[model samples]
Target: MNNISVIMIAHNKKEIIKSQIEQLSSIHNISMDSITIVDNHSSDNLCDFLVSQSRLNYIICDDKIENYSLILNTCISEFVNTQNDILILDPDSFLLPETLKKLSCALNPDNGIYAVCPQNILDISNDIHSFSAALNYVNNNDVSKINLFKIIKPEINTILLSHKLLSEHTLFDSEIISDELCLTDFCINNILNDQFTYMADNVYQYYIGNHNSYYSPTNRNCDLAYIRQKWHMNYINTIPSSNLISMINEPIDKELNVLEIGCDCGATLLAIQALYPNSTLYGIEINPISAEIASHIASVKTANIEESVDLWNDIKFDYILFGDVLEHLRNPSKVIHNCRHILKKKGKIISSIPNLMHFTVLHELINGSFHYTDTGLLDKTHIHFFTYNEIIRMYEENDFNVINTIASNVTPMLSKKDSEFIDALTKLSSHKNDMLFKAFQYITLAEIKDT
Candidate 1:
């Protein structure tokens, strides 16, 4: 039988650490001796509090070390001296009592399960959706054969690593300051080398927060802008030029005219140009800074996309793309109506909106917090939310027919198995008896009717 050691690392998470510990304590079946916490120079009195707890063995590291992988490896090593099975946890991750036990039972010492992650319930926040979006993009259809290493690079939270696996791979590299991609890089390399098999099942809940290593407020507002631009540019350069040939559902042979509403930095427009050599793309942006960036990127790529929202009235388009933009608008319906007017007969509008009804959002609302962020369904800039029905209604109301709808990030709620419990909780939180489930958002396509 494998003995389990839960290793948790923390920095400035003092405010939530005590509650996390308490929650861990309340876990019914786990032995009290199995948990360990490492505080890596938290400026607060988190260390003192942990030391006083009789149930936990705590370690305090010097303040100078800030990289999470180093702190994580140290905690695992210090607690599980022998090659015991270990579960690494982020401070914000919460687990049910039976979670660890289930994981332990599933581990095969022969094939050696590299790591197992619980079905994550992400806390809604800015850039949280980007990760969610990426997850949705990968898991959209049949994910059984999806290349895990190619799709998801490792990062922090909800990973269980075997001691043998750790020893063979060596401790996480301390030199990588950027926590965002380091762990994922390690996981990919190791998985490719067949060091261990990565097995993720449904077990834990992740409280999405602004403090995650990559999406900090400073990075979201600035660094991410550059990163997204590069990602977009790379995406553009990779596709074949012939892929740009215009193919609206319509059979029209007229030169294709494309409109990209809310074209942030024109990366997608540039991509469209490369894909459809004969097409003319137009970009419409609301933010001047982003618009200027788009124009600059266009110039740099030598992509020809007529840019201007001022020309909205005179221009016509065979295809218009919303590209993760509609949900941010105060009135997405109004925007759709406007797009309908400018679209030629049978022209299609393609969009990718976050599914506001995603299971993660439903999980959060039931738990009693609906904090909004600068991105995703709750982005500070977003004034509207949509469901499949709502989006269909909006298009139908605008004299457009709903042609196709693809539900992404459609993972079921971690707590959904307990529908009765969820219903009971919903009743308790009801004002006038509405379930009030918050969806993550959805993407849809609609076509304007011919006269």
Candidate 2:
């Protein structure tokens, strides 16, 4: 077995550190001698506590290096040897019994995976018995049974670094000022290098405290803006729409021509290309930054999709996808009506539209707070809102017949005080499954109405 060095950053949280250390010590594969605590000049006598623990190693950082990158680089240079695999751990993370073992097992150099992270339970309580129960559940159940997420970016809290990866690249980006963003930069670098990060879905890490407390609001905003400027696009724009991808039900063998509206980074188009290798993919993205990235993957053009029907008048598409785009358009009905000119006779328009009549929206309105947010049901960019009936009517009125509808519902937790309002609303609604109160979005497939 290769030497594993456990790296932990401490900042005035002594009790949580103690609990984390105790949990690490319980792991049979890891020894207490391998752990190293880098104290960030804590005034709570955390360094003194580390000094008393003879089995574990520690470093007390002085006022000389205050920046997170410098401190991390200094510790890596001094403590972690070239052959050692490093585990960067958050102090508030409570590891399951087999977390280290699972992480180490998945860190094989043969695979292109450079880093391994355990699944985090952010809402989990700090109970050892609860962790034990979760461990048991993980052990007995198949991996598919657990709700696993396919992540494009690295998650915070607990991550294991491979020695092969560390040798090739620096662990953290010195240019990034924020500690949180530096890791994100590192992840982006890994992705660029064609190396990947794997999440150990079977392994669990119990996280305590607010995840956003590490960086101040000002720093976070500045760093995010910097990252966006550096990367040419925001992280959210780069992510593929999984729900929209699932709504595409086409024959695998048939080579279909597909066009996506607002194909931000061409991620979904690229995914479609993968699904149908022989198919042709086209995209229209308004943002030039994201359009440039997506242009490499598909025949992407930058245009205001709301008024760009002239661009695709000569070409006919088998499928025109609007993934949460109609709501953001000033004239969605006009766009839908214009689709007939560009769509093949048998072609269909598949759109994922947000439900305006969701319980959360109703609840907010009942409390007199129908406020707009960055992204959600009441997004600042959304120009139109539609319920299920309105969505069907919109398509039918636009010379299209609704072929199928799939509801994506999420059961919300309502306050006890608002129960009476919801009860009265449910009693009045005609939908049988409380779909009006629960359906978050509707993925509708519509075809041209036969004259």
Best by lDDT: 2
User: Per-candidate TM vs. native?
Assistant: 0.43, 0.70
Clash totals, every prediction: 16, 0
How would you encode candidate 2's per-residue C-alpha lDDT over 11-60 as one tens digit per residue? 77788788878777765355787788878768788888899998887888
The per-model lDDT (C-alpha) reads 0.57, 0.75
Q: Looking at model 2, which ten-residue stretch has the lowest summed lDDT?
A: 143-152
**Per-residue CA lDDT of candidate 1, range 1-451, in tens?**
2366777777777777776766666753445567777777777887788878887778787645355566666676666756677777777666544555556655554664566655453532234344345345334433233111111222335666666777666777554443453454455445444443333434334554553563245533443344345333211111111112232443334467887776655556655553455677677765554455455333212221222233655667888887767766667777777676677888888877765555456667869978797555667766677766678888888888877765554436445565554455457663422223433444466788766
Output the TM-score of candidate 2.
0.70
Model 1 spans with C-alpha error above 4 angstroms: 25-33, 53-55, 121-156, 195-202, 206-211, 214-451
Query: Which one wins on TM-score?
Result: 2
**Model 1 residue 2 lDDT?**
34
